[model samples]
Target: MGSLLLLTRIGGRPAAFRAEDIGSIVELTEIAPVPRAPDFVAGLTGLRSRALTVIDSRKALALPGTPDPPDVRAPVVEVGGHAYALLVDRVDDVVAAEGEPTPPPATLGPAWARVACGMIETAAGPAVLIDVAALVAGPHRAAA
Candidate 1:
C-alpha cells in the first residue's frame, strides 16, 4: 500500500510528515507570545475557535537561533488531544511515500533521531520523516 506524505522545509532542511498526521495547512498571520514557555514554543494562535500552540520546527529539529518573522506557513496537527501549529520555513508538496523505510541517518544526531520515525526517498530527495506525536511529546514530557 502507498502512503501519502506532506513535504516541508524546516530550517531549510527537508522533512516529511505523514498526510494523516496533518490536520490543516494554514498561513500564520498572528502569534501571541506565551511567556515562560519553552524556547521551542513559538507562540499561540487561533485556529477556528480553538487556540493552537505553535512549535518552532527549526528549534524542534535542534537547529540554531530564533526563526525569522512569521512570513511562512504552518501545518496544524493534534497531539495528546491538543492542537499544535508547526512553524516551518516552507511547505513543499504532498507526495506518495514509496519503498521501504530506512533508518534515520546517524548524521541526524540524537536529538533529531528521537523525533524522526525514519527516512524515505522522494522525487525531491531523501526526507526525514517526522513523528509528530513524539515531536510534540518531547517538550511536554520534559516539563514534567
Candidate 2:
C-alpha cells in the first residue's frame, strides 16, 4: 500500500502532505501579525491554548499573496518542537496514495523544487508531495 496523503491546494495548484506528518486541520479566525518575522511567516494564532506560527504556503513557495478572507484554512504540524499552521488555498480530502512518489519534473520551478519531495498519484490524480518540515522552514531557511 502507498502512503496516506492529505490533499490540499497551494498557490492554486494541487499539493499533498504525508498524512503522518500532519497533526490536524484548522480554520484560523484571527492571526496577530508578527513583526520582524520572515515574509513567509503569516503571524501567530492560538489553538487549544497553544500558540501556532502560521506559515503562508504561498509566500513560502515564493508566490504572490492574494487577498484572504478573515478566516483561513490550514494544516497543523509540529517541526523541531514548535507548532506551525500551513495556510493553504484550500483543503481537500484525505486519500490513499495510488503509488509511490516519483521525482518531480524539471519544470516544477525553484520555489517548488525547494520544498517538494516528489510527485505522487492519488485517487484525486497527481499532486506534488510537499515536505511539511520544509514548508514550515520557509524558502530562505530551507535553501540555506
Candidate 3:
C-alpha cells in the first residue's frame, strides 16, 4: 500500500521521510557516540535492547553541518536492517502522491541526487522520493 510521507525541516530545509520507513516516533534519550564513522552518522541510541544509529538527514544530504538544534526531534527508521533517526525540525502531516512517480531529473546535480528515485508532487510541492536503502548503506565510505 502506497502511503504518504510526513514532512519535516532538516536544518532549515524542507524534507520528508516516508512514514513507512519510520518504525515509530520516539522521544529523545541518551544518544552515545561511536568512533571512526561518517560525520553524517549522528550517533547511536538504545531502543529497549536494540542500538539504533541516528543520522542527521540534513547533513547526509550534503547540506551545511549545523549543530543540531536541541529542540529538533527524530524518527527512528529501519534502514539497511538497522535503525537510524533522521533528524528533522518537526514532523508534518502525511499526504499521498498526487500522480505517478517522476523519473530522475536530467539536470539534477550532486552525487546524492542519483539515489533519489524521483519526485512526487504533493500539496506543498514535490518531495524527493529517496531510495533509502541505496541512500544509506551504500558503497563503503572512503577514509574520513
Best by lDDT: 2
**All candidates' lDDT scores?**
0.83, 0.88, 0.66
Report the lDDT tens digits of candidate 1 across residue range 9-76.
Answer: 77667889999999999888899999998778879999889999988877776777544554367899
Residue 115 miss distance in model 1 (angstroms): 0.9
Candidate 1 lDDT for residue 43:
91
Candidate 1 vs candidate 2: which has greater lDDT?
2
For candidate 2, write residues 1-144 as lDDT tens digits.
Answer: 777899988887899999999999988999999999998998999999999999988888888866354226789999999999988888888999998899999999988998899999998899999988888877765354
Ranking by lDDT: 2, 1, 3
The per-residue C-alpha lDDT of model 3 at residue 43 equals 82
TM-score of 3: 0.77
Clash counts for all predictions: 0, 0, 0
**In model 1, how large is the Cα lDDT of residue 2?**
57
| TM-score to true structure, per model | 0.89, 0.92, 0.77
Error of 1 at 129 (Å): 0.4
Model 3: per-residue Cα lDDT over 29-138, one tens digit each: 67787898777777888778888787766566666656445544667777657787666556666777677667767765564474566776778777676666655553
The residue ranges of model 3 lying beyond 4 angstroms of the native Cα positions read 67-71, 138-144
TM-score, candidate number 1: 0.89
Using TM-score as the measure, name the better of candidate 2 and candidate 3: 2
- Lowest summed lDDT over 10 consecutive residues: which window, candidate 1? 135-144
